[model samples]
Target: MKPLLLIILYCAAVTLPLLASWLVGGPPRPFRHELASGLGILAFSMILMEFVLSGRFKKISTGIGMDVTMRVHQMMARTALIFAMLHPFLYRGTASGGQRPWDPTRQLTITTDFYDLSSGITAFLLLPCLVLLAVGRTKLDYKYETWRLMHGIGATLIAALLLHHTVYAGRYGSQPVMTWLWLVMTGLAIVSLIYVYLVAPLRETARPWRVTSVTRLTPGQWEVTVAPEKHPGLDFKAGQFVWLNVGHSAFSLKENPFSICSAPAAGSKISFMIKELGDFTRTVGQIKPGTIAYLDGPYGSLTVDGRNEPGIALIAGGVGIAPLLGILRELRQTGDPRKVKLIYGNRTDNQIAFRDELDEEDVTYVVSEPTAAWQGEKGFIDPALIDRVFSPLEIKEWLFVMCGPGIMMDIVEDHLITRGTPSRHILSERFDYD
Candidate 1:
């Protein structure tokens, strides 16, 4: 459905722009150039919408479509950036030219009249686009919030400048009807960006949650609880995640989605047990109690959304147990009679962060290492161990929710695949780095 919508929108945007240019007596070169740019922008928008609508709902771990979609979006954005920058450069010496690219260097030593002011101002925004592409993925040392804000501002500046230039100087966009169409298309892109930024954050703030307590769960792990002050905002089913913002300081800029660890109806605070693995997680320990935190959704398709199988089997490793805890707590709250078996792995018994919580829950624990007086299942979870525990008949009727280390999920997925389990039957999530 999303692909169909994208195709329709792309054709309309391209055809309308070309027809409008022809009707306005626009030159052949400018019309062809602007049409190409419009198509690129349309392609970029379609890829973005497709990811938002369908990428998150996919059950399989890997697919060719997912890879292609990501690649298309990235390439189209780069292409649009180049074309936008070059549009003014081609019109440098023309009477309609506003600013020259070389104006900045010339103004360094003395006053200049050779300035094409409009194009130069537009080119200034190119700096941000180049920087953002250079630091793409936020994989560098910069903070996530800082990078996101800068990237957003840069993209906005470019779009605004491009829109202004096209309206005033573009030959195709000079006529009233053509100008309105150009403005409308650009407006949609800006609106989409606003939805991604301003609108989404505002929606998140409406969720009811206040910081209750923070405790150290492991060497660098903190378990923070956010209970409702008055009434619960919404109950989260197991296997769903909420987008969280710590305080107003970085609220708008930094919204990291973390899986809920407590049941939605526990009458207690919602909890998130996170390891200090990154810059954002590291600062969570300093979060004071009574601080207001905004939560945006209980999103994701991994939850047991009523698949009437024989039972549910859950697997987790280390901090990945957060989502599994949500499912278990939810099951207990709803009085679900389905038998649930959990196989959780960790480096050692001591590092099993929520030991007390797991022991209290109606689930099995598979600890990898136990030094003294250890009596639980030992060693890594492999295909042989799973086969020994459950028969083929039992496996067929069981719904598997596997989360944790990516490698472990891969091994379990492969084992299930070998046993002829459909990929849709097994659900997993991992912020894995390739």
Candidate 2:
């Protein structure tokens, strides 16, 4: 589906509960009380929707690029946190007591019952902590897998707590129609989690892969190739990535996203150029050639399969060259007539991967900290290097696909825009959403 339609659907889904609550009319309450209820309803709905926005669903992520989808997820999460934090405070001045005989719909008095309020209190305390941990995950001293597990568990617990609070303590939610709506919404959220952690793993288990080779490309980088055991292998575009689980259980959280460095035309075998960063990546060189593995993707929107641009510009920094290499390889294999050029940058010349293969292409090798014997472009892949590499007409007309460090991408994107390149022609995927 198109991005605009997906966005429209997302907005409609998130606001469905609030619209339903408003339609289920009750005795009129003060604006403050209604506002509190509305905020609470919206917050709960958005939280439930976060499961789908986790970037696991291809329908959502593929249409809007994984980076864009993740950015939306992060922004919406913070927004929902704000709404939830203000929900209870807005009801402070409203009447609160046991259910009164006259207030059948609980319009005149808010519930003070321990059972109804306990869940809300607990969720209120936990919500901020969850958001804070997520926002500061990279800075925290924990494994990525550990953070992922904690985030999943914490979100599930909070959702359950909020469900109880909303259906029991909420004035609008207490109504039968609204109660049913909340229950259904929460059920879907749980189902989404199950689909990701359970169903997907089961499917991956059935279609396993075996490592064929592990070749060191640089001091800190290795190329790991895997072939499907019996299946025909992944049918993915050239520049996509997959969640690779090597020598681990299908359901393990040890999997990490790695870009496909091999072209789709390169047969059923797939290759990933991994850098030794941290966590699972640090163990890439240690992995044996015949180890069992599972793949749970082919996700990302960094391909140039059907573009009509006159040329293609590939910009890379460090390990970001993985996906771009796949694209370049596919273009060469297909005998594509369009012009292609690559600008690959690294901290040092020794850090560049696939030197023999890349040297065969129209590549500009750049090193931020070059050795005395180093040649080619020096310094980072900045505006000056970009201007030196491509002509003004090429910058405006060529399709630019980049993946790299956040700062490099930011600089490249800004320069591309400044050089009269339309946003639609500039494509990038980020490793870090923050």
Candidate 3:
């Protein structure tokens, strides 16, 4: 779906509970009380939607791109945290008692019922801890898989608590219609989690793959290839990525996201250019050729298949060349007529992968730590290096695709805009989501 429509749908979904609460017709309370309830409703709705956002839904993330999806996921969690914090404080001035003669439903007064109110209190405390943990996930020194599990469990607990609190403690939530709505919405959120962790793995179990090759490319980088065990290979775009689980069950959390360095038309087998960075990746060189594997993907919206740009420029730093290599290989394999140039940068010449395959006529190699005998570009891919390669027209018109460290991407993107390149013409993906 179009991005604007997706955003509109999201806004409508998030606000529906609050709108429904207002339409249910409750006795007028203080402005602060209603505002508190409204904020709570909105926060719960957004929190529920966070499940779908991070659930790896191709329809949602593919439309807006995964980077935007993840960024939105992080930002909205903080927003929901703020709203949840303010929810109880706003009800401070209201009376707390068993049953009031004027308000028999207890709609105007804060309920003293510990059973229903305790859930809200628990959620209010746990929500901040969850957000803080996520914000400091790397600093916590927890394994990514461990962090993912905790994040999921923490989120599920919070969701359950909020659901009970909303249906029982919320003024409008006491209504049967509103209670049912909350149940259905929260059920969908839980189902989203199940679909990702359970359903997707079950589907992948039937179509397994095996490691075909694992060749060391650079000092710490390896090129790993996998072939389908029985079924036809993955049908994906050129620049997409997959969550690869090697030597593990389909349900295992040992999977890691890797870009498909091989083109779609290359063959039935797919290759990934992986750098040894963490626990899973450091062992890439030791993976046996016949190790069983499961792939859950073909994700990412980085391909340029149907774009109308006259020319394309690829910018890469270190192993970030993986997806760009896929695109370049596809263009060549399909005999694409569009002009293409690659500005591949690394710390040294030894770090450059596919040196024998990179077309000399089209590639510009930049090494930050070049040898004394080296003669290629000897600096970073900054604005000066970028300007030295493309002309004014090319800089402004050609499509620029990049993937690298956050700093390099930011520098290149800022320079592209400074060179009069429209924002639409510059596409980038970051390797580090944290």
Candidate 4:
């Protein structure tokens, strides 16, 4: 279905303008050309975003699936950039191939035309920015904040340049139908981009949460809660996260995404149970409240609504429990009666973030390292434990949502697949960001 849609969209993008012009009985007008280019660029840009943006597609795609999608999006972005570069080149104010309207590529090549040069320079600049971003993301391992700023600015510049190129060269502003379509589509794309980049980041900056408290649960483990400045309702679903601006102010581009352990109903307040995992996250404990902070999120679709299963099975290892807490809190609020079984793994009972909270849920604790008088399920979540707890019917009907370390989710997924459970039934979220 998706492949068919892609083909149809591509065909329409390439042929629709020519067909419309032919119908109008003349050379393809600038208005028609502009509208065509605008729509084509918009469609292609959306496809490109899905691969780069760390969101639903990243979570859903099984390993090799992401690789394929990324490659395709990369190629499409490069191609679309070329078309944007050539918008003025091929379509603007010129006679081509004996004035034949059908000759699409008559003036396609780059030349000394100023408008064409402007468009070409803009495209050339924008394309390399995207390339650098992709390279920095995949190969160079650039700083997240740096890449984010450059990417936002670069994208905005490209959009502006393209709009300028289209208006001046394609002349859509003169035709009512073409003008309206161009305006609407351009507005929509700009709105989406702004929402994703500008508005979203600003909202995060306005969050009044200050780090009022920070507690170290154990070695390499900590929990931090920010006190709300006032009664600002932060409505967020479970299994969603808010980006945290630690050290620097929220206005800065250096924010990290973290899941809220507390439910949304908690209102005014949120808690993030985190482990001292990395360089940026390790500093999560030192952040002082009364300082500005930003939270841009509540993103992800690992909720219960989409599942057709009878019940849910939640598997959490260490800090991966963050999103699960959101889910569990949501379940508690709604008075959901669906049977839920949570298998939480930790080094020991003391190392667990929300030990008491897990006990309240329909959950079992697995302690990897036992100290003193403690006896419960131990070791990693192996297949034997899974078989012992869930029957064949239950396995088939139950929805498995796992969020934790990559290896843990991988093992659990493989085990579920080894049984009769289909791949779709088992869902996992990656807590690790590259």
Candidate 5:
């Protein structure tokens, strides 16, 4: 499950169809035409593989981390777009028209069959729109759920079009063996989508969860807890997260991911420290207790369990503290003997959540904009603050787990590297994937 191994497996899956297509016997064609076909095959294969990559498979996300998995998904989509864009242009020198009796194999003549060519044209147009919308999702005015639904539907349509075009028009794909392979691969991609929306929702409907309590932790932050109804609670590691759906059907796309803020040892009720940030999140304060809720997670690889480091360093910015708080509470309730310290940062004093429970002896609360009454550390959670809190030996030897704004994570990670901490020793989760 190491990262390199995952990459190797992924490369094999995406390139397998391309390799097979090339291996199938065919009359010699110009290198440009063959290259075009190969690129098209590779693009479609990569597009289908995107479904598996974005399917939230723990085998992939848990191994390389969700941030890396998502990043790879985005990069591959763009790469596939480039290949798809260039595919047809490279075949310009080949003869194009209706299929001829003389060139039955499509060896010397490109197909001008309207249905076959139309599918390819449709996919080419739709693929760019899908990629552009995804790249600019945050810039547009739309709900995250709305954007998610559009993205899913668009990608599925493009996949179907690409499959039809590949099997019907492709010289290699017209072979019985290649046609079967394309069908199987495309079927698997659709199955992944079905599993997410249909199969998983059906299972969740059987084991429902309900809102147990909602407590205001700060001005804009609330801790909402959900308890299993007639069921044992989720069995998850300390620093994982869940996709929470409150007051929505199990099949709804209104779910939003939030890290578990309460410890597993705290009992069957799991709580999330949510800030008013979006359409769903901004209304968290109004979500009454006893409302129905559905959970689909315990995802992410941010836990420090079983680590051999002598000290554990937790760094957080804003509500990114949710998962870290779970880790901190777990370490305490279990009476973990390892030395632990926390550096929680915020822009203003009132933004810090769960301040009462944080053991002042080990927690450093940093505020960039402190009121006159402020007494704790002032300024950003930068290298200077980090150096002030952690010893040189602890910096190099201890485990560093962090989740926060992208800027803060980058700064902390860069500083950790500068302090000679091994990359493996530093763990981080990104709140905004955009």
Candidate 6:
């Protein structure tokens, strides 16, 4: 689906319970009480929807790009946290007691029962912790796999807590129709989790891959190749990525996303150029050939397979060259007639990977910390470098695909917009959304 349609569906899903509660008419209550209930309903619904927004679903991630999908997920989580935090406080002035005989609809008094309120109280306390841990995950000492597992489990617990609290304590949610709505919505959320963890893994177990080679390209980078064991290789376009799990079970959480550095036309074997950064990545060189691996992707919208632009401009910074290399190789293998230029930037010359191959193309190497013998561009890949590499016509007419540090992409995007390049003409993916 397109971004607009996905957004429309999201708004409809989150607000469905709120709308159902409003439709399930009851005795009128104070405005503050109704507002509190509405906020609670929306927050619960948004929390449930976060399962589908985890960027594991191809239909959502492929449409908006994983970076945008993840950014949306983070923003929505914080918004739900804010709404959840304010839900109880808005009921301060409302009358609070057990359901009274006088108020059959429970409109005159709010529940003060310990059982009904306990879940809400616990969830209110845990919600902030979950959001804070996610926001500060990089700074924390925990491994990425550990943090991912914690995040998934914490979210599941919160969802269960919210469901109980909403059904028992909520004035509107206590109604038969509203109760069923919450039940169905929460059930769908759980099913989404099952699909991601259980169903996806079961499918991957059938189509395993084996490590073909692991070659060191630079001091901190290595090229790992994998071939399908018995099934046909992945049918993915250039510039896409996959969640690669090497020497681990299909169900293990030891997988990480890596872009395909090899062209689709390069046969069944696929390659990934990985940089030593995190716990799993630092061990890329140790992964022996023929190790069993599982792939769960072909994601991202960074490909240029069917574009009609007169030329293509590939911009890279550090390890961001992986996906762009795939695009370049596919273009060369297919004997594409469109013009191509690559601007690859790194801190030092030795840090550049695939130097022999990149040198054969129209590449401008940019090094911020160049050695004395360095001869190519000697600066960062900023707006200045972009201007020096491409002319005004090329900037406006060419298709620009970039993947790199967030700051570099931001600067380049802003400069492109200022120079008459339409937003649609510029495509990019970022490793960090924050």
Pick the winner on TM-score between candidates 3 and 4. 3
Kindly list the per-residue Cα lDDT of model 6 for residues 338-433, writing each as its tens digit. Answer: 999999999999999999999999999999999999988998888888998999999999999998988899899999999999999999986574
lDDT of 6: 0.93
Per-candidate TM-scores read 0.70, 0.98, 0.98, 0.68, 0.97, 0.98
Q: What are the per-residue Cα lDDT tens digits for candidate 1 across 106-220?
A: 2111112333246436544674454465436545777767776765676666656655654554444446887787677767767767666667666555555789899998888
Kindly list the per-residue Cα lDDT of model 5 for residues 1-434, writing each as its tens digit.
Answer: 78899989899989989888878968888899998999999999999999998836877787777888888999999999999999999988678986578877556778888998999999999999999999999899999999999999999999999989998889888888899999999999999999988998888898799998888998989999999998897989999988899999999999998999889998999999999988998899899989999998767888887789989999999888999999999998899999889999999999988787885539999999999999999989899999999999999999999989898889989998999999989999764556
| lDDT order of candidates, top first | 6, 2, 3, 5, 1, 4
Candidates in order have lDDT scores of: 0.64, 0.92, 0.91, 0.62, 0.90, 0.93
Distance from true position, residue 394, model 2, in Å? 0.4
C-alpha RMSD in Å of predicted model 6 compared with the true structure: 1.0
TM-score-wise, the better of 4 and 5 is 5
Which regions of candidate 4 fall more than 4 Å away from where they truly are? 1-115, 138-141, 164-184, 195-207, 246-250, 265-268, 277-279, 289-292, 305-310, 329-338, 345-351, 356-385, 406-411, 414-418, 422-427, 430-434
Task: For each of the candidates, give the backbone clash count.
Answer: 6, 0, 0, 3, 0, 0
The model with the greater TM-score, 2 or 5, is 2
Model 2 over residues 79-118: C-alpha lDDT tens digits? 9999999999998877688667888656778888999999
TM-score comparison, 1 vs 6, better candidate: 6
lDDT of 4 by residue, 1-434 (tens): 25455456645644443344334343344564545445544533443343333332323222223323445555566666655555444445544332235554333322344764486366556666675575557455567777767766666566566555544444233244544544554565567666666666566555556666777766777777776655464666667666676656556777777778777765667778777755677776666655555565555555565566888888888887877877788777777788888888887878776666667877877888977777888887778778877888878778998887788887878888888888878766553333
Best by lDDT: 6
Which of candidates 5 and 6 is the stronger one according to TM-score? 6
Q: Cα deviation in Å at residue 211, candidate 5?
A: 0.8
